[model samples]
Target: MNGTWLTVLMAVPLVGAAVLAVLPRRIDGNLAKQVALGVSLVTLVLGAVLAFSFEPGGGYQFTVEVDWISAFGAHFALGLDGIGLALVLMTVILAPVVILASWNDADPVDAAVAPGRSPRWSTHSFFAWVLALEGLAIGVFAATDVFLFYVLFEATLIPIYFLIGGFGGPERAKAALKFLIYSLAGGLIMLASVVGLYVVSADSSFGPTYLLSELQQVDIATDVGRWLFLGFFIAFAIKAPMFPVHTWLPDAAAQGTPGTSVLLVSILDKIGTFGMIRFCLTLFPEASEWATPVVVVLALISIVYGALMAIGQDNIPRLIAFTSVSHFGFIVLGIFVMNSYGGSGATLYMFNHGLSTAALFLVTGYLIKRRGSAQISDFGGVEKVAPILAGILLFAGLSSLGLPGLSPFVSEFLVIVGSWQYAIWVAVIAVTGIIWAALYILLMYQRTMTGPTRPEVAGMSDLKVREIVALAPVLVLILGLGLFPKPLLDVINPAVEDTLVFVDGASVEPVATAVDDATAEEGDN
Candidate 1:
C-alpha cells in the first residue's frame, strides 16, 4: 500500500472523472458536483495521510518507478520531496473548495447562467474537468522522470483550456484560445529540450535514461546545456507567465469564472517556479547560474510592473490577476537568489499564495454573482449588507499584501532576507513591491467594499452556509500557518538546502560578519 500510494493518489480523481463522463445523461448537476466533491475530499485525505507519514528532511518519500518506454529509457516514475509535498497538499485542499464554490457556476437552469455567458457543457463537464486537472497536476508535481514530467505538464493544459473556454464571461472563447496558443507554443519549445536530453543521455556510457536521478549524472558540454536550459526555461516562464509572457494571465483570469481563475493562478502557475528548481537548477546548475542575472532583473521588472498594472485595473478579477504577477516575481526572485532562505521561502510562498488567492477569488466571485458585475466602481459599501463576504475579502486582501501576521508575510520576509544575503541592492529593490502591494490591495478594497452603500448592492445577501463551508478551511489554514509555520518550514528547509547544495548556491557568510572579521584582523596586526 505504501509503495502504491503515489500512483493511487494520482489515479483517484482521474477515475472519478471517467465515472462522471460515462454516467447517464439524465443525471442532475447536483449529483455530479457531489461526486466531484467526494473524489476531491478523498484525495485530500490521501494527501494528509501522506503528510503525516512523511519523515521531515527525508528525500523523495512514497516513490514509484516502472518502465514505460524501454527502448528510449523512459519510466513512469514518481516521487515526493518536501517541495512537491507542499504543492500536492495545496492542490488537493483547493480542489474541493473550488468544486463547492463552483457548485452553481454551471447550473442547468438557464436563469442561473450569467448574462452573455454560454456554457459549452453542463455542471458534469465542469466538475469533471476540475477533477481531471487535479489528477494531472498531481502527476506533474510527483514525476521524477523528465519525460513523464513533460507529458503530464502538457496534459494539464487540456482541462484548463476547457475550464476557461467552456464556461466563462463573453470573452471566454477568445481568452481560452489565447491561453492555448501560448501554452502550446511553450510546450513545443520544451519538446525540443526533451529530445535533446534524450540525445545527450544516449551519449552517456550507461546509455539513455529519462529518469531525473540518472540524467543528473550525465554531463554535456556547457553550450549544449545552456540551449537545452533555454528550451525548458522558456516553457516554464510562459507557464509562470512572467514579464512579457505574462499578458495571457490577466485576460484569462478576467474571462474565466473565479473557480477557474483560482486553479489557473494559484495551482497551475506554480509549475513554472517548480520547474526552475526541479529541472533548471538541479539538472543544469551552470546554466541556471549563468542565467541568474537576467532572471533577477526580469523578476524585478515583473514585481514593479505587475504591481503598477494591478493598481490601474478597475476590473476586480484582473486586479487580482496582476497582483499575482507581482507576487510571482517575489517567488522567482527567491528561486534565483541561490540560497536556502530564498528557495525555502519561494516554496512556502507557493502554498501560502494559493490559500490567500483562492479565498480572494471565491469571495469576490460571490460578490460578482450577486451584483452581476465585476467592476470595482459598480460595488460600494458591500460590508453594509454582506459583512461576512466583505470581511473575508478584506482578510484575503491583507494576506495578499503580506500583512505581518498572515502566511504571505512570512514567505515574503524569507525571500527578502535570502535576497539580502545574495545581493543587498536586489533585496532593497524587492522591498518596494511590498509597498506597491499595499496600494493595490487597499485601493481595491476601499473602492469596492468600503464606500457608502450603492443601490446595486443594497439588497445583496450575506454568505450562504455552503459558501462559508467552502472557505472555512482556507481561512483557518491561512491563520494557522501564519502563526505556526514551523511544520512546513521543517519539511521545506531540507529540500531547499539540498537543492542549494546541488546548485552550489548555498548561503554564505554575511558581508557584515566578513567585514567585522577583517577589521579585527587589522587591529591584531
Candidate 2:
C-alpha cells in the first residue's frame, strides 16, 4: 500500500465521524451507550490492523508525504517509529475504554437542553466525535512533518473541549473554557517560535520549511534556541498540567465524565512529555542541557507536591488529576536524565501509564454512575456487592502503585535506574513520590472496596456482561505486559538509542557538574 495504510487509518475514523453527526445521540437511554461502544470498537480494530502489520524497531515506517499548503511549504506527512507505534496502539486500546467509561451517560447534555429532547439513547454523534478524536490523535503521533504535526495537535482540543463542555456537570463550561484558554494560549505562543525558526533560515525561504526534519536541521544560537524551546515547553507544561500551571486540570477532570477524564489524563496529557522528547530534546539539545537541572528540580517538586495534594482531595477524579502532575514529573525527570534507561523508561512509562490510568478513570466512571457522586466518601466498600468491579479497580490501583510484575513497575524502575547514573539525589527524591503513590492509591482502594458495606452501595450491581467484555482486554494487557516486558522493550530500545545520540556525544562530567550545582542551589533555597 506504500504508506497508504496511514491515510486509510486516519480516514476510517474521520469518515465514521462524518456519518455520526447525522445520527441521534441517545436511544431509550441504553441505546446511546451501545452505539458509542460500537463506533469505538471499529476504530480500535483498524488501529490493531496497523499494529499487526507494523515492523518493530523500525525508525520511521509507512511514511506518506504530500504537499498540503504549498506556498508555506507544508506537507501532509505521516510516519511511525517504534515509540509512536506503541503509543498509537495504546491510544486505540483506550478509545474503547473511554467509550465504555462513558457508556451509562445519556446524550451530550447540550444536545438535550437545546429546546429539544435528546434523541432517545442513541448517542451516535457522541461516538462519532470520540472516534474522530482518536483518528486525529493517531495523526498527531504519526505526523512526520512539523506542519502536519501541529495541525493534528491543535485539532485534538476541539472534540475534547466539546465533550467536556457539552456533557459534563454544571461547571462544565468553565472547565472547558479554562482548558481551551490554557491550551490555545500555549499553542499560539509556540506558533511565534515556529515562525521565528523559519525566518532564521539562510535562504530566508519559508517555502522550504514547515517540515520537521528540515526544522531539526536548522541551527540557531543558544539564546534563540532557548526562547524557541520555551514556546514549546510552556504549551506542553500546561498540557502536562505540571506544578504551577496545573490548576485547570483538577477542575476539568472533576467536572468531565470519567471517560473524558481518561482521555484528558492518559492520552492528551502525554502530548506534553512527548513534546519534550521530540521537540525539546531533539531540536534544542543545547537548550535542553541548559534547562535540564531546572526542569528536574521542578519535576521533583511536582512529585512531592502533587502527591500531597492528591492525599488532600476528596473528589476521586481530582485525586487522579493531581496524580498526573506527579506522574508527569517522573516523565520529565526521565527525559532530563537523558540516558538510555531514563529515555526508554519515560517512553515505555507513557505506554504503561496510559493503559493503567485509563483503566482507573474509566472504571471510576462506572462507580460514579452507580453512586451518583464522585465523592470518595460516597463509595464505601462496594466490593460487598460489586466484587468483579472491585477486582478490576484493585488491579488498576496496583498498576498505579508500580506493583511488580506489572507494566508500571518495569517502566518506573527503568526511570529510577536511568536517573541514578546522572544524579543519585534525583533518583532518591523521585523515589519518595512512589511511596506517596502507594498511599493515595491504596487508600482509595481501602475506602471503596473494603470494610463494612454501606446500604446504598451494598445494593450496587456488579459488572454486566458487556462491561466485563470491555474490561478484559485491558486486564490481559496488565498481566501480559507485566510478565513479559521484553517484546515491548525490544521495540523501544532502537528508538531510545537513536535519541541518545546527542546525550551520548556530550561530556557527561560537565553535565553532572552543572546538575550538582543546580541541586546545591536548590538545597540552599
Which numbered prediction scores highest in TM-score against the true structure? 1
Question: What TM-score quantifies how close candidate 2 is to the native fold?
Answer: 0.90
Writing each residue's lDDT as its tens digit, candidate 2 over 1-23 gives 35898888777777767766665
The numbered model that scores best in lDDT is 1
The global Cα lDDT (0 to 1) of model 1 is 0.91
TM-score of each: 0.96, 0.90
Model 2 residue runs over 4 Å out of place are 24-39, 108-122, 202-207, 504-525
lDDT of 1 by residue, 489-510 (tens): 8888778777776675456343
List of clashing residue pairs for candidate 1: none
- Judged by whole-model lDDT over C-alpha atoms, candidate 2 comes out at 0.79
Error of 2 at 326 (Å): 0.8
